[model samples]
Target chain A: MEIKTLSQDGVTIVTPVGRVDTSTAKAFEDGVMASISACNKIAIRFDEIDYMSSAGLRVVLMAGKKLSAIKGELVLINMPEKIFSVFKTSGFDKIIKICQTFEESKQFFN
Target chain B: MATAANILVLDDDEDTADLFRQKFRHQIMDGIYKFSFVIHPEEALDLLQQQVFDIFISDINVAGTDGISFIAKLRKDYSFMRSIVISAYGDINTLRAVMRGGAHDFVIKPIDFKDFGDTLAKTVRVVEQLRQAEATSRKLSAISDELGVSAQLQRSILPSNSLKKGNIEIWADSIPAAEVGGDFYDFFWLNNAKLGIVMADVSGKNVSAAMFALIAKTLIKSFSQIYTSPARCFETVNRTLYNENATSMFVTAIYGIVDMEKNELTYTNAGHLPIAAIRHNEDPRFLECEAGMALGICEDIVFTDSVHTFSPGEMILLYTDGVPEATDKNGNEYDYERFSEVLRQNAIMSPNLLTRALMESIREFTKGMSQSDDITTLCLKYRLRVTPNVN
Candidate 1:
């Protein structure tokens, strides 16, 4: 897995590529938590991510809970339909914010 | 600062072996780098036989048993040793042979000194990372085993033998999808007049959900002692869960209180699936008890109660979503239609047999496929009263 972070105006955009499974879930969690100390508005770009399992969902749920406690926002953008299905079935779509495009995610800032 | 571990270099060329030793020495003075140069492969084997080493680097074209053979022989006994082969003539076939012979890596002719050093460092780092991961997985497996035992203990907390409290005959079964499930069911007597029935499904699966289910059960039991009304019991549980839950996970539950003498059953549903009530010799119908959201999602949520009269031989069946949502191999759900049919077929059987037949039918429908969610079922059958003569 590859993770890159870009920060602007106190918002951090995290682009993750490749599959996130049990083997790499911890690294993904660490990368997301590292951004938590500095940025309140976080956006995750999952366009390149091909797959995710329950272990991956656990990490995202953990980050969501952390951000919610601080009254911050964690937005997911451009998720692949296959990966998005898992979230929707798990009811995470109701609890977390998801945007169809990066432009739509920027609306939260406005 | 921790010192890098010692590495052993075995090469036929004395000059090349010395260069390899000097390169690692310059990287860290505190770290010890060891070199053993042998003109033939036999001498290298002798050295390896005498002592243990963190790594072994060799030339593929060494005389008297080439590097590929040496690696194959060494791996038979010293399986844990990390081996790397360096070759002046970078033969793709030779590289593949050495790798298949258990060599960790291969360096080509005119080795870029910088790349060689970095590769060596990375090889060690990768090995250490693998070791740590193995250790962690072992710990997690042990903890999971312990949790499985605790889950069995939790199942034992349910009433094993039915309490002949009034005219209600209650039977419940909980089956976890994995080693531990988040589904729970319990029925306990509040007093001579009332009996409380609780069924809950916590979000997520495994240990997190199992822990929350236990806590929810405890809170409901403790609070129901003070307030016997079904609505009040759920209100107290929701408030307590909202304050105590740190993960923000929620639970769907139904709490019912049966007044045996008055033949009244009142219940509050908190985002749980609707319960089914089958009248004596009549078809099953879903109870009209829908009001509240899932618990632990918000504070000050209101839950309304629904009351119904329980006739003799009538039955009420409560279950987690796992039953209705169970899917077959083709992704078709078992659903409420099949569930009610199973109830109607086995409605005449004893409560225990009814639950067993329902589960058997689900198993048959799925064709022995693995259950994806926890399955929980609770049934209450009201019996007719026998007249007594007053002396």
Candidate 2:
């Protein structure tokens, strides 16, 4: 998995570019941690993530809880349908906030 | 090596700087070395922070900071660069200070042009060797990472957990050796009433064999959907494999189609191991078949098929040779006799427990020796719902 970070209006945008399965889940975690230390408002764009298994979900949960502890916010945007279903079925959608577009996600930080 | 080597020089004397330019005139003209000079030690320290240099050449004392203290700072931070200290004093204390400060070499002033040139050449040689070693180490790490990803990719291609469809509960498990193996097993619904099952073993080990196993599995599956008849499916798969067989590898496989409504299983064997089945209240026995040749050989060979009616509470087991052929520390195999005996004894158990019992028995027999081949097995139990009578 490749992680690209962009900072826009104090919100960190983390874009992961591949399957977030068991093998690459740790890399995803590290990428999130790198972006987490820099800013409080974070947005993870899942447009390029093709397949995500339970391992990826675990990382997402951990990121959510960590950000919550610091009174920071994390929003997921542009999720592909397959990965969205996995999130919904696993009940992660209820715990983590998700949005359909970048503008909507940015409003959470505002 | 073609790019000019960046060299940083710190000396207070102007003539010494001129001497270096004159001495390395040929190398500088050839574009082999690029030189940068700093008259003050503090200025050199600031320059060091801004850019990287291949070699550091400094005198014992400069305008503001001493060479030993500067060398100490450089060693604490950018220790990878080579440092050569030039000094007018040849005392043992000065030599010890230079060495303790992490200087690569110490040269006395009143420098000889020939000696200086030779020293510079040696320093550059050492720098090149270090770069080459670091590059090789990085390349090796990249290759290791790619292999790890390949292994994980291979694992993801396999079916996860057992599933119950129609009247059959199917469980398949495979434990690959330390290296990747060519064992493969798959089951999918051919229709609402029929389930297609496949178990195969390719000829070799490692990546190439695993790739061949994938191709063979895919071809057999696609062929089964098109042909329907077990024997005809094998024939078509064999012909396709023979045409595409570039590695000269062969695959031993057995394909079965189970019809839930008819309670019948029709199967074809391609030089694979005999499957064991336990009918209701009967001892486990190997299903009989005329063993045909493995696929990826000759294209003209025809395969034969066998049929068995599976009653409720009956179970059938399919496995690769890795099970019976598993070896002990004394090199004795578990053998087909013992394998069948274990199945016969545990025939009444559920498919999941039975498979786990067999795996545990094999582990006990092997005494934790490294596996030589992949051990794969599939246990399919035909379960019927028992209806309680209400009065």
Candidate 3:
């Protein structure tokens, strides 16, 4: 997995590409958690992400709960159709905010 | 921030080439795009040969030859290059031909700059993804290569071939359940008249288990040089291993010293399987020695010493649980009862032949079942007299 971060208007967008399985889950989790101490709003961009397994989901849930405890927002944006389906099937769509576009993601902070 | 796309444009028309170059010049200056231009297919090929490009854009109706043929030749040489065909007049047949010739995308004449830019960006992303996958695959291959070398090293620790010392003929065989296993066996002359034999099984399989097995085997040999008693040898080995090991791993072993001059065998069993002894023209029986706990478990544990009298033409066999617990296609174990029966039947053969026959029987029993653990066995046949023996 490759993780890249970008910040716009104080909201940090983390983009992770490639499969997130058992071998790469720790790196993904570390990347997400590392941003939590500094950023108030964390946006995970899944526009180019291909697939994610249970291990990846566990990290997302952990980051979500951690950010929530700090009274911060954990936003998921531009999820590709394949991964959006996984999110929906896993019931994560119900608990996490899903934005279809970057504009919508930016609006959530405003 | 948007990363610039490094685009290579190949077109024969000077006006079209300049226009293509000018269109990206502003973006290039703004750090959103980078461009390279070539006027001919050969020039494009030469540029590709010189340096790698993120994307290749070529005119379909170039002078001298068509873009389809160029793509075909390019695909033959560099299948990894991402190529796109541009034409003023789009032909369905030509489009199909260029696509079949390995063009990544087709653009109609009077290119819509927005669509073109998007296609170029997507192409660059595809190329980057491919490069990343290749790098990861190479790294994985390197790790696999290292694992193979470790497995080879593990194999080297086993006895090379069968050998005879004095009146005792020793033969051993080991088969790992995977690329590497935890089972090991070794034999060396303890003295001019005493030969030492050892067989052990580590708790797990693969590299970690093989490493521990090597450590245990080394400790046994090193300790045996100072302690003549089998129990004392195991005690020293256990203490050393217990201090060195951080993980909660253990090993079961059988160590014995065979005195060929007196025809006596003294051994200690460290939570290992029972040893079988068959005397000439007598029924085979388990050695029934007092067993001790596995090594590297607790430092205070003690191993008991056991002695047995060996007569001429007698045989002793030591093995790991992998042998008796081996299951067949029917899920039936080749248990101790069947193993003893096979050993008794093959008792008349030489130690080497008997070990081979035992392995053959196991292979037959587990016809379709994959070996689930490491199988190791050591045999020592005592020949009383040094005279010419009948085969």
Candidate 4:
């Protein structure tokens, strides 16, 4: 998995390419954790994700928990329909802030 | 000596033995160092082959061999053994040869007993560190071996691959991954008219997932008998799983009951995938229902039950995330498109053949890649629904 991190105006956007399963969840976690360390505001872009196992959701939950502890914000954006379906089925939508775009995340955060 | 490091020293000089023994006599008595001197290179090689020694201290002019070749052979064959070469004149060239030949350190001759002792002690400390690391690796391997044995025993206790009762014919199997996975399934006779079915996957893998799977399977089976509706049964089981979830792990499951008298299959989903249905002469489709939150995530979730008709020869397939999510070498998923294709082509297949076809399809798509998740599937075909008038 290749993770691209771009930070602008105090917000870091993480774009991960390809599957996020057991083999690559650690890399995803590391990228997200790195972003969290540098900035409190983060948005995960799931546009290129092919598939994500429950292990991938575990990482999301972990990121959310870590950010909550710091009184920081973690938002999910641009999830593919299939990926969004996963979060919806898992009821993660109930617990996390999800939006249609990074702009929407900024508006919601503001 | 309990903690003594056995040191093998090679030298032709007969007086070297007595000098080492005399100088380290107090240390030997205190059980810290034990020196074994060999006059010939062959004798040193013989002892090296037979036993594990802590250190090899050799003189460059030892009898029967050139020192560099012998030290190099020891370095190649027993690289972990600490070696120190003796440079007879504090010769820089001899010291360079010793280092190049892979000897760890060198001591000069006319030997400084105190300096020599200090060098040997340093090498001994390195040897002790290696010993501790070896012990830890051994312990870890032993623990993994135990996990392997426990997984085998659990496989023995898994529900049989196939079960038939009344009008329902079921074939269920949970394949074990390289590591122990948390997938489990079962189908049992609840009564003459009711049959219970379960398919579930606990989050993650390893011992905790295995244990959680076992606990959730047992509780679901027990609760199925106590509650008639799948919703009610899952409600109680969900609470138990939530209470028991210290690690915050969750279980995605579908627990259903087939009522032969009513010809209905009613089930409750807990964050599991949708059940696929293959009805004769009708388009294959996933059962329409709420996929719901997984058990142990929240304690207060109110589960809802969904109903599907079990018409004669209707087949239902339930699987874990391993299926469909199985990725190829190019990272493309064997997604629901393939899943439905398999179901459509094998709609008339017996529960057993349908399962084989599905697994073979997945295997074909993921021939060279390794799947980390457990692939579990349960197939049920209602051979004929029970009706008093038909009999």
What TM-score, over all chains together, does every model reach? 0.54, 0.56, 0.56, 0.67
Off by over 4 Å in 3: A1-110, B1-4, B26-32, B139-184, B187-195, B201-214, B225-232, B238-252, B257-274, B287-314, B320-339, B349-376, B381-391
Give lDDT: candidate 4, residue B44. 89
lDDT per residue, candidate 4, B254-342, as tens digits?
Answer: 98898888889999998888888898667788887876678877787888999988767899998988887887888788889998888
Candidate 1 per-residue lDDT over residues B6-96, each given as its tens digit:
4666666678866766776665555534455666777767877887655677777773346687788876776556777888886888789
The full ranking of all candidates by TM-score, starting with the best, is: 4, 2, 3, 1
Q: Model 3, A1-110: lDDT tens per residue?
A: 89999988899998888766445777988899888878979999987665564346657766777887799888898988867755553345656789997789877776
Model 2 error, position B4 (Å)? 4.1
Task: Give one digit per residue, the lDDT tens place, for model 2 in B221-338.
Answer: 8888898888899898989998987645667889999888778889988867778897655678889886676777657758788998887888999988779767787767787777
Q: Which regions of candidate 4 fall more than 4 Å away from where they truly are? A: A37-39, B1-152, B385-391
lDDT of 2: 0.80
Task: Work out how many backbone clashes candidate 4 has.
Answer: 0
Most accurate candidate by DockQ: 4
Give lDDT per model, in order. 0.77, 0.80, 0.79, 0.84
Q: Which candidate, 2 or 3, has the higher TM-score?
A: 2
Q: Which candidate should be chosen as best, given lDDT against the real structure?
A: 4
Score candidate 3 by DockQ. 0.01
